[model samples]
Target chain A: MRRLRHYARLLAVQMRTSLTLAVQYRFDFFLEGALALFWLAITLIPLLVVYSRRESVAGWSFPEALVVVGWFSVLKSVLDGGVTPSLNFVVEGVRKGTLDFVLLKPADAQFLVSTARFEPWRILDFLGSIAVLVYAFHRLGHAPRAGDLMVGLALFGVALILLYSLWILVVSVSFRVVKVDNLSYLFISIFDAGRWPIDVFKGALRLIFTVVFPLALMTTYPAQALLGKLTSAHALLAGTGGLAFAAIARFVWKRALRAYTSASS
Target chain B: MIRARKLCKTYRVHRRPPGLLEALRSVVRRRYEEVRALCDVSFDIAPGERVGFLGPNGAGKTTALKILSGLLYPTSGSVTVGDFVPQDRRTEFLHMITLVMGQKQQLLWDLPPAETFAMNRALFDLPRDEADATQKELVDLLEIGPLIGKPTRQLSLGERMKCELVAALLHRPRVLFLDEPTIGLDVSMQARVRDFIRRYNESTGATVLLTSHYMEDVAALCPRVIVIDKGHLVYDGDLRTLARRIRPEKRITMHFSSLPAPGELDRLGNCVARSELQATLAVPAAQVTEAVRAALGRLPISDISVEDPPLEEIMQEFLGGQPANGGVRSA
Candidate 1:
C-alpha cells in the first residue's frame, strides 16, 4: 500500500507537469480534440452506410456495432493519450541512452517509464468516446443489468491490463532493436483490427484474432457484457489471457534489460 | 560505497556497412558480431570519494558506469553499490544513487525544469517540505533561479545542464555516476559545473564515479583516475602518479620582458618552444626548480611557472593516440 501511494504521488506530479505543458500549446490541444470528434463522425458514417444494406452482420445490429465502435474509440484514445506518450519515453530513452537516468531513480523502472509523459488532450478524446458509448446504449433503448455493468467494468480493467502488457513487450523489444522506432505505429495499425467485433472474422482468422492477437478481448467481449450477450466462460478466458500476457511482459522486460548494453556516448 | 569484481559486459551487435546493397541485404540476412565492451574491469570506491574514469570514446568507460548504476546487466562478474546489487535495481539501491549524463536531458523537454524536479521529489518519495527545501537549496546553489520557470527546450545548453543537475539531485542521492556532465559547456560553465560537483560531493559525502573526455574536468575534480584502453584497465591510481608514470617531463614556461638569446636558455632545460615574449622548456621533474632559477638568472623574465604536461598529452601517450588491446597496471 505504501508503494502504491508512492507511485500515485509520482504519477500525479508527472501528470501535473504534462498539464502545464499542454496549457502552453492550448491551440494544439483543442485542435486535436476537434479532430477526434471529426474522426468519430467520419468513422460512423461509413459504417452507417454499410448497416443500411444489411439488418445485421456478424450477429451485431447497427446500434450494437456502435457500442463496439465507441469502445474502440475509448480504448484508442486512452492508449494514445496516456500510455503511448509514456511508451515513447521508454523507446526514446533506450535509443538515446537516457534510460540510464531513469534506472538511477528511486522509483520502479517500469513505473517511471509508464508515467513519465501524459497527453492532456488525449483525455478530451476519452471523454468524447465515453459520451458516444453512453449515446449508443441510450439508442438501444435498454438499460444494462447491474451484474452485467459490474462484469463489463471488470473486463474493461482486464482488457486494459492485457493491452498494457503488450505495449510493455513492444517497448522491451525496442531496447534491443533501437533502430525500429516506429513499433508504436505498427501497434496502432494492428489495433485497427479491434474496431470490428471478432465475430466478423471466420475460421482461422477468428481463432487468430480471439486467441493470438486478442483484439476481440480488448473491446468486443466487454461490449458484449453490456449487451447481455457475454458468458462467464468467455470472461474467464479473457481474464486468463490478460494474466498470461502480463507474465509474458514481465519475462520479456527482464530479458530485454539484461541484454541492454546502454548506448555509448 | 562502490565495488566491482571482474565486471564484464559484452554486446551482440548487428553489423552492417553503409550502402543501399548492405541495407537491402541486412533486411533479410544481417550479421551479428560480439563486441566486448568491458573485460575483467574491477574497482572499489569508498564513500565521498570522487574518481574519474578516463578513456577515449568506446573504451568501455560508459559501459562500466552503466553497469555500476544498474542500467545494464554485465555479461559476467558482480557489482555491489551501497550494499545493494545494482543489477537487481532494488528501490533502495536506486534511492541511494543518481546518474547524470550530459548528452541526455532527463527534464521534460516541453515543460519547465521545476516540474521535473517536483516529479523527481515525488518519485524519490521525499516529504513535500523536504522536497521543496532541497529544490530551493539546489536551485540557489546552481544560481538557476529564473531558468526553472521557462520551458526546458528554450534554455541554452549550459542553462539546461545546470537545470538538469537540480532535477537529478532532488532525491539527495548518496552516489552519483556522472558521464560527461560538463560536455559541450564553455570553459567558464565547465569550471562552474566542476566546482558545483566538488561542493556537492563535499557537502553530501556522495561517492562520485565520473567519465569525461575533457582533461581539465578530471584534473580539477578527481584526484584519482582509472584509465581504460580497449576494454582494459590501463592505469588506476592517483592522477599525479598516472601523469608522472606516463609522461615524466615537467613543463616550465617563462615569459620574458625582452627577447632572450636562443642558445642561452637551452642549457637550463630542453627548449620545447621559444618565442620573443615566452619560452617553454621540458625539464626533468627533479630539476624543475633548478631550471626555473637558472632561467630567472639568465634572462629578465616577467613570469615563470612550472606544471605537468597537460593531461591530453599524457592520455595521448598513455593510450598511444588510439586505445589498443594491451596490458595494464592496477593499484
Candidate 2:
C-alpha cells in the first residue's frame, strides 16, 4: 500500500510536469483539439451516409451507434494519451539502458514503467469523449437510471483495465525482441478494430476480437451497459477476461524483467 | 560494507553481418556469441571506504558497479551490500545507496531540477522538512541554487551534472556508485565534482565506488584502487603500488643549456624524447641515483627532475602487454 502511494506520487509528478510542458506549447494543444474535431467530423460522415440509406445499422439506431463511437473515442484517447507515452518510455529505456535507473529503484517496476510519462495535451481528447457521450445520451431521448450509471461506470472501469492489460502485454514483448520499432504500430492497428461495433464484423473476425484480441470488450460492452443492453453473462465474461489479462500481463512483465541484460552488459 | 564472491555476468549477443543478404540470412540462421562482462570478479570493501574502480574501456568496471548497485543481476556467485542482496533491490537497500551514471540522468528532462527533488522526496517518503534541509545542503554544496529553477534541458552539461549530483545525494545514501561521473565536463568542472564527492564522503562517511577514464579523478578521490582488465581483476591494492609495479623505470627530464651531442644524451639513459637543449630519459628506478649523477656531472644541466611515469603510459603498458585474445586471467 505504501508502494502504491509512491507510485501515485510519481505519477502525479509526471502529470504535473507534462501539464506544464503542454501549457508552454499551448498551440500544440489547440492543434490536437482541432485534429480531433476533424476526425469526429469525418467519422460522422459514415454515420450520416449509413443513416440516410437505412434507419439503423445492424438493428442499432444512429444515436445508439453514436454511443459506441463516443465510447471508442474515449477509449482511444485514454490509450493514446496515457498508455502510448509510457510505451515510448519503455522502448527508449530498454534501448539506452536507462531502464537501469528504474530497475534500481525500490518501487515496483511495472508501476514505474506504466506511469513514467504523461502527455497532458491529449486530455483534450478525453474531454471530447465525455462531451460526445453526453451529446449521444441527449440524442437517444432516454433518461438513464441510477442503476444504469453504476453499471456504465463499472463496465467502463473493466474496459480500461482490459485495455491497460493488453497494452502492457504488447510492450513487454520488447524484452525478448531487440527491434521493437513497429511494436506500437502493431498495438494501434489491433486496437483500431475497436472503432466499430463487433456485430458489424462477421464470423472469424468477431471471434478473434471477442476471444483472442478482446477489442470488443474494450468499448462495445461498456457502451452497451450505458445503452441498457448489457447482459449479466457478458459482464461476467468481461470481468473474468480483465482479471486474466491483468494476471498474464504481470507474468509477462516479470519474465521480461528476468530476461533483461542491461545495455552496458 | 560491500562484498562480492566470484561474481560473474555473461551476455549472449546475437551477431549478424551488415548486408541486405546477411540480414535476410540471419532471419533463418542466427549466430550467437557469449561475452563475459565480469569473470570471477571478487572484492570486499569496508564501510566508508573510497575505492577507485580502474580499467580500460570494456574492462567490466561499469558492469561491476551495476551489480553492486542492483541494476544487473550477476550470472554466478554472490554480492551483498550490508545485509541486503543487491539483486533483491529492497527498499532499505535502495535507501542506503545511489548510482549516478554520467552518461544517463535521473532528472526529469522537461522539469526543473527542483521538481525532481520534490518528486524524489515523495518517492523516498522523507519528512518534508528533512527533505528540504537535505536539498538545501546539496544545492548549496554543488552551488547550483540558480540552476535548480530552470528546466533541466536549458542547463549546460556542467550545470546539469551539478544538479544531477544534488538529485543523487539528497537522500543521503551511505553507498555511492559513480560511473564516469565526470565524463563530459570541463577540467575545472570535473575538479569541482571530484571535490564535492570527496567532501560528501568525508562529511557523511559514505562508501564510494568510482569508475572513470580520468586518472586525475582517481588520484584525487580514491586512496585504494581495484584494477580490472578485460573482465578480470588484474591488480587490487594501493594505486601507488600498481603504478610502481607497471612502470618500475623513473622518468628523468633534463633541460640543457645547449643542445647535447647525440652520444652524450644516449650515455645518460634510454632517450625517451629529444629536442633542442632538452631531453627526457627513462631510467630504471634502481639506477636513478647513478643516472642523475652522470647527467649532472657530464652535461651542462640547467634543471633536472625524476618522477614516476604518467599514469596513461602505465595503463597503456598494462593493457597492451597482455595477450590479444586472452580473457581476464588473475594477475
Candidate 3:
C-alpha cells in the first residue's frame, strides 16, 4: 500500500510538471489545440469516403467503423500525451546522458523515464475522440448496456497496456541502437491501420494484427465489447495478452539497461 | 564508504572509415574495436572524505565515477558504495548516492527549478517537510533564491549549475560522484562551487568522489586525489605529496625596492619569471630557505614569500612523464 501511494504521488508530481510546462508557452498550447481538431477532422475523411459508396466495408457498418476510429483517436491521444513525450525524453536522455539522473533516482527507472514528460495539450485530442465516440453511438440510436460498458472500459485498460508495451519495446531497442526516431515514425504509421475494424483485415494481415502487432486488440476488441459483440473468452485472451506483452516489455527493458553504456559525459 | 577493486570497463566501439562507399559497404559487414576505458583501477574512500579524480580528457576518470554511481557496469571487477554493490542499483543503494555531471543537467528546461525539486521530492519519496527543508537549505546556500523561480533556460550556465547541485543534493545522498562539477564556470564561480562542496561534506559527513579537469578545483576541495592517465592508475594519495613528488621545487617571488642587478636573481635559483619590479624563482625544496636568505641578504628586496609550485605545472610534468602502463602507487 505504501509503495502504491509512493508511485501515485510520483505520477501526480510528474503530471503537475507537465502541466506547468504546457502552460509555459500559451501560443503552443493554443496551436496544438487547433492542430488536435484539425487532425481529428483529417482522421474522419477516409471513413467518409469509404462509407459513401458502400453501406458497409467487410462486416462493420459506418457507425461501427467510427467506433474503431474513435478508439484509435483515444489511443493516439494517450500515445501523444502520455507515452510519446516521455519515451522521446528517454531517447534524448540516453543520447545526452541526462538519463543518468533518472537512473540515479531511488525510484524505478522505467517508471520515472516513462512518466518523465507529457504533452497535456493532447488532452484536446482525447476530448475530440470522446466526441467522435458519442456521435457514433448517437448515430447507431442506442447506448451500450452497462455490462457491455464495463467490459469496454476493462478492454480499454487492456488496450492501453498493450499500446504502451509496444512503445516500450520500441524504446528498449533504442538502448541498443541509439538512434531510433525513424523506428517511432514507423510505429506511428503502422498504428494508422488501427482506424479500420479488424474484420477489414483478412488472411495474413488479420493474423498479424491479432497476434504480432496487436492493433486489433488495441482498437477493435474494445469497440466490439462496447457493441456487445465480444465474448468473455476473447476478453480473457486480451487481458492475458496485455499482461504477456507487459512482461516481455519489462524483461526487454531490464536487459537493455544492462547493455546501456550511457553516452559519454 | 566506497571501494572499487580492479575495475575494468571495456567498450565495443563500431569503427569505420569516413567515406560513403565505406559506409555502404560497412552496412553489409561491420568492424568493432574494443577500447579499454578503465583497466585494473582500484581505490577506496572512507566516509566523509573528499577525493578528487584528476586526469586529462579521456583518462577514464569519468568512467570510474560512472561505475561507482551505477550508471555503467564495469566489464570486470567489483565496486560498492556504502554497504551495497552499485551495479545492483538497489533502491536503498540508489537513495544513498547522487552523480552530478556538469556537462549535463537534470533540471526541467521549460519549468522552474522548484518544480523539479517537488518532482524529486516525490521521486525520492522523501517526506514533504523534510524535502522542503533540504531544498530551502540548499537554495539558501547556493544563493539562488530568486533564480529558482525562473525557467531554467533563462538562467546562466553558472546559475543552472547551482540549481543542479541543489537538485542532486536534495535527496541528501550519502555519497556524491561529481564529474567536472565546476566545468565552464568563471574562476570566481568555480571557487564558490568548490567552497559549497567542501562545506556540504563537512556538514553532512557525505563521502565525495569528484572528477574535474580544473586543477584548482582538485587543489582547493580534495585533500586526496587519484590520478589516472591512459586508462592506468598512476598515483593515488595525498594531493600535496603527489605535488611534491612530481615537482619538488618551491616557487619564490620577491618585490624589489630597487632594480636587482642583471644576474643577481638567477644566482639564487632558476628564475622562471621576471619583471621590472618583481621576480619569481623556482628553488629546490631543500634550498628554498637558503635561497630566501641569500636573496634577502645579497639583493635589494622589499618582500619575499615561498610557496609550492603551481598544481598545473606538477600535473603537466606528472602526466607527461607517465608511461601508458605506469604502475599504480598509493601514499
Highest TM-score against the true fold, candidate: 3
lDDT of 3 by residue, B1-331 (tens): 8888999999999999999999998899999999999999988899999998887778898899889989898999998888999988899998899989999989989888888888888888999899989999999999999998999999999999999999999999989999989877888898899999999999999999888767777888899989888788989999999888878889999999998888888788998998898999999899988998899899999998898887776777888853311222111
**Candidate 3 off by > 4 Å:** B256-259, B274-278, B321-331
TM agreement with the true structure for every prediction: 0.94, 0.94, 0.95
| Residue B107 lDDT in candidate 3 | 91
Error of 2 at A144 (Å): 2.6
Error of 3 at A71 (Å): 1.7
Each model's DockQ score = 0.75, 0.56, 0.84
State candidate 2's TM-score: 0.94
Q: What is each predicted model's overall lDDT from 0 to 1?
A: 0.85, 0.84, 0.89
Q: Tens-digit lDDT track for model 2 on B53-124? A: 888778899889988988778999899999999888799999999999899998888778888888778667
Worst 10 residues of 3 chain A by lDDT: A92-101
Best by lDDT: 3
Assign candidate 2 its CAPRI class: medium
- Tell me the tens digit of each residue's lDDT in model 1 across A237-261: 9999999999999888878877665
lDDT head-to-head 1 vs 2, winner: 1
When 1 and 2 are scored with TM-score, the better candidate is: 1
